[model samples]
Target: MNLSGVFYLGWRYLVRNRIKTLLLVAAFSLVWLLPSGLALVVSKIESQLRVRAAGTPLLLGQAGSPLELVFNGLYFTKPGIATFSFGETEAIDESGLATVIPLYARFSVGGGGGGKYRIIGTTLDYFDFRGLELREGRGLIDLGECVVGSKFADANGIGPGDAIISSPETLFDLAGVYPLKMHVVGVLSPSGSPDDQAIFVDLKTTWIIEGLGHGHEDAEKLGNDARLPVSAEDRAAAGETGGEIRLNASVVQFNEVTDENADDFHFHGELSDYPVMAAIVVPTDAKGQAILKGRYGRPGGLQLVAPSEEMDELFATVFSVQDLVLGLLGATGVGTLAIGALVFLLSNRLRRAEFRHLLHLGAAPGAVRALILFEACFVVLSSLVLSVVGLLAIDRFAPVLVRSFFG
Candidate 1:
């Protein structure tokens, strides 16, 4: 068989029936990329979620939807679990199972794309716990200061000293309480995790936004311009009765405080009046987590769920459908391959006269056979490459589709 003869014959065999060749390639490409693309997307999302959830030992939250609670506390996506008491938060921290970083993620910031980069009111330890770093600006240093993740900063075109305003937590209904406006003093570097898509503020800042804490009291009404820290002692010294607004906005318009005048400037609220969505807990590992789960998973008590386990279950449920679809696609791809094979086989048989003429002129049977194989392979491979390119384009836009359909 002459190599040159094989090349000549292969080109003729494939290009001769242009329409059939093109259709076969198209079918092959779709068959090749559909399942692979779906698998790639699912795997990517799962891996990202799992990586973020790794250090998390447990999620402690209000007795509500376990999925929502986990999403809020762990991913900072859901509206969030209720705030655990200082006592409850402390016990979990002292649980000796896993070092706990109390997370209170309920407040929203306006101007940040997707609402304040998912504001998380947590302690300084939370940053270290998450392995996040400072890229351009420092971490949260003061109560009013905030550390925005790189993506948050990039999206908002904001940097240090660029303030972020707090919006009411719930946009769905007015039933949710209003969180006060907060500031963004710092921004963080990208951690390549969900943290990269978040904004961080101090626990006190969250308390302030939740109306659990406030800034200053109206001085003229109190008959003193002296700075007053609203500690237990200060409250006692002032002989203040009824209630005091924990936050005193430097930006509050009115200054006077009195029965007649006090209602104008200072905003007042009780600590317990504020609602916190959830807290994150840490147990040692899977076994310790199981033990902890047994304690909280009782019939009518607070629910404790492992996010990874729940996420896995969720992924499994969704993928079961995907698996079925992929199986059908694979079968169809195989069928397409069979049909294409038949087409080429018939084409080869039809070419016998041409082959015989060539053979008479010195073309070998081996060359003819090789020509047939080359044409088939070229069709399959071309299809596969085109399919892959199409799949990548689909992936680029898949998130929007996923949100549109599933969200």
Candidate 2:
């Protein structure tokens, strides 16, 4: 029996039955792609999340879901269930064991193409802590001024000297909720994390948006003896007593913070009482983390957790999902094999006349069997190659796909 002759005959038969060959290739490729592709994608997502979590030592937030806190702190995706007092930051700073960085991520800015990026209210220390460099202009030097990330700037075609107006959190009460325009002073270098998708501004900027801070003319300066031209309703609305001072239509909200009115931006209450979404705590040493955890681990209003540990907890759930997906894929693969076998047996039956003619021509039975086996081998080899190529393509696009799905 000439092995090359048998292989050639097998290849020629498959080519003649092109539709069946294509179907078999697709089925078998799916059998390989499902399980392998799933594992590859999960691993990529887990690796990316873990890498981001690794840089963040600990997340401190109001007592709530640990997953939500970690995701919000690391990814800037989750809206905090509750907010912790800025006093917590003061206390942590005074502790001397850890440095706490406050995060306020409550607003979003929608650019062209309906792409909305989170507006992160933090401080200059956040840049220093993350080792972020200004790619274009200066850092955020004043309130209501922002430093955009490289990806965000590129996506929006925005650069230094441009402005970003925050989207209104709600549209029903237009008067109460005003859109703030922030000055774009700089763009950050690519950091390969959620930070690259954010617009960073001073925490005071968020406070102003929240109605916790404002700028206005002193009502005391406008005495009762002075004749006021404004109506009583307008005066009362803009008055500093039972309502917000800057309320009426004439009370123009400072859309952009600049040198002219930056001094006028003042908080209504003590800075310590202001809210922060979460705190990123970096302990001085191993002992410091242990100590900080022990201090805050008690039943309390706030919780402190290591992001890496929270991620491990998350992966446990992910593994359970992976197992379920693999089980389904395994069942599907078994069905594919059964269908493949049926197709093979049916093809042989259909070609019985051809086989009978070959046999009458003095072709050996063993040679016929070798031809069948070679065809099966070819199908398996082709499927393997196609699956490998498909998996590689998926891996190459995994980052963008994951960001689109999760972010």
Residues 1-407, candidate 1: write the lDDT tens digits.
Answer: 67776887678767777888888888888788878988877876666567656656677776868778777776677763455554565665677655556677766667432464577778787777777788876766555667887877887798876766777645553433344544556667766666766778877667666544544435555533343357777778878762764433333432211234323432345433444566567666777667677878886546777778878887888799889989998898889778878887887788889878877988677876787778888898898789878878877866544432222
Pairs with steric clashes in candidate 2: none
- The local distance difference test score of each candidate is 0.67, 0.84
- Per-model TM-score versus the true fold: 0.71, 0.89
Badly placed stretches (over 4 Å) of model 1 are 12-19, 80-87, 94-99, 110-116, 168-182, 210-273, 283-294, 315-319, 345-369, 384-407
Give the lowest summed-lDDT range of ten residues in model 2. 240-249
lDDT of 2 at 374: 90
In candidate 2, stretches whose alpha carbon ends up further than 4 angstroms from where it belongs are 2-8, 111-115, 217-249, 405-407
Given candidate 1, what's the lDDT at residue 181?
A: 44
User: Evaluated with TM-score, which candidate comes out highest?
Assistant: 2
